[model samples]
Target: MKKRVITIICFVLIGIVQSNAQVTFQPGVKGGVVFSRLTNFDSDFMTGFYLGGQLAIKFNKLYTLQPELVYSQQGANSNYSDLLIDNYYNESIITVNNSVKHSLDYLCLGAISKFSFGTGFHVIVGPSLDFKVNDNFDKSYFYSDSPIGFDFAIVGGFGFSFPNGLSLDARFKQGVVDIYGNNYNTNIDNNNNGNYDEVVLNQSFQLGLSYSFDIK
Candidate 1:
């Protein structure tokens, strides 16, 4: 998987290297709603918004390489019950029900390759780098640490374009990095290595609309 990601990046870099030649440029704006959740937990999906811009470099009639910068908000809500825990003073055992809302904000940078087929239908595949800007959860809540700072993910989708430069796409993003890597609370750490024995990843689906302006 790592090797595949490296190969994709190399191809994108090659595209950048070729930009010195003549090409077509299209500047675009995009916005979407994200249905996001944290995997490995029974949590409800959180609906958030994303807004971004993209610059599309057209190499030929059927291909374009687009670079985008986006701001996205994501999170989930979880309700857990029947938990046993020692008191803060380490004196007695107590049962509690915990409900939490995890919220995160990120700045996402992506290089997406767009492949157009017949009749304006197209497919997009890309790699994304997400920088954690802010999150509502802290270390005390996780009993280990906050969520990871940077996340790597793959995004792919299909869309249709209109002659007016309006387009719509639906994409799914799967995180390659775990939100909690080897850090677990006593409730989850059975091996005492702070390992939860499982990985927690970010999964989300996006529906977006974009409009582009042609430039010389």
Candidate 2:
């Protein structure tokens, strides 16, 4: 699947290059804050930041292809409880209040297609691939390891560019795949089926500003 995604990306890049002769290339840097949380987990949004650079391939007055490389931080604050067995015949009940902060960092590659309407206003939608760079969690109790290292998300947003080359945008990203292994077994079997029934995913909102300069 990774290979297939890489292949698609390559084809998109090739198409962009082939179409660039009639357009312009603009490069820029952006920085922003991200409000992120884990889905299917009892958690709250964690505030983090992202920094990146992007290349915008303007195909016409109304269409553009923007590709970016970004470093982003994401995670959540969670508090929950678990039941443990103290012995074969004795079950111990304990309440676990987890104040631990999880810090997950990723190097992401994203490609967005932009559609412009009036003036500098536009709508953007795209896909992103996140490669985990690092992660840390407070290990005071039984904590699940960070979700599988690679994540994929669908992104959508709106933005406007000023005549002075400054732009502002807000986007929402939704993970299309489970961050945790799909087959991971949870400790709780509410249905008494003896099988795990929980899954975790990633969701985030990003707000950013950038300055673009034409390169061609």
Candidate 3:
């Protein structure tokens, strides 16, 4: 009986060691383009890219935690509807006459939860926080304030990791908050006097690749 117990204890210890050996602590980088669009906005889709790195810690057979940092682009496009009548004395009417394009850039930080199904396959889901880095706007219209809103988004994706520590991933990010401020009024002033003009939001889809480090 004593001998049998010793054998069992040894087997348990060996199994624990083997289990730990299967896990990896890794760092990786990813980049890809987002085919993006804002729902209900005039512009169809915006193309942009994201580049970033992640620190991954494997906990067990099915789960891992990864924290990431990336530079991402986000925004929307719209057709300018009217030309603003410049004369103050004349009856003011700003007719919606043309189309416009705008863009916003962000430095994003995210946390991802990974669930692995088998060798080299995994699914990742998480949330991201974005800080506005820059903005691009069309020259013709005079928008009084910065149109960028929504400081965060929920992101999710799936991909696989190779034995060499390289990983490939495709992700989707969606805004949880309204990107436009409540003060924005889209009313058209027919008299051409400069007043509140309607504006649209830009949203899009992103597809990309990520490379991870191998831990031995």
**Total clashing pairs for each candidate:** 0, 0, 26
- In angstroms, how far off is 90's CA in candidate 2? 26
Report lDDT (CA) for all predictions.
0.84, 0.83, 0.72
Q: Write the per-residue lDDT of candidate 3 for residues 1-216, one digit (tens) a residue.
A: 999999999999999999888777988888888776665555656677788788888888699998899988766556666567859778687786665556778788888899988777989898888777887553425543565544667878888877677777787787654455543333435764433333343345677777777655
Highest-TM-score candidate: 2
In lDDT terms, how accurate is model 3? 0.72
lDDT of 3 at 155: 78
Sorted by TM-score (best first), the order is 2, 1, 3
Q: Indicate whether candidate 1 or candidate 3 has the larger TM-score.
A: 1
Give the higher-lDDT candidate: 2 or 3: 2
| TM-score per model over all chains | 0.74, 0.75, 0.68
Worst 10 contiguous positions by lDDT, candidate 2: 188-197
In model 3, how large is the Cα lDDT of residue 95?
A: 82
What's the C-alpha lDDT at position 208 in model 2? 94
- Residue 15 displacement in candidate 2 (angstroms): 17
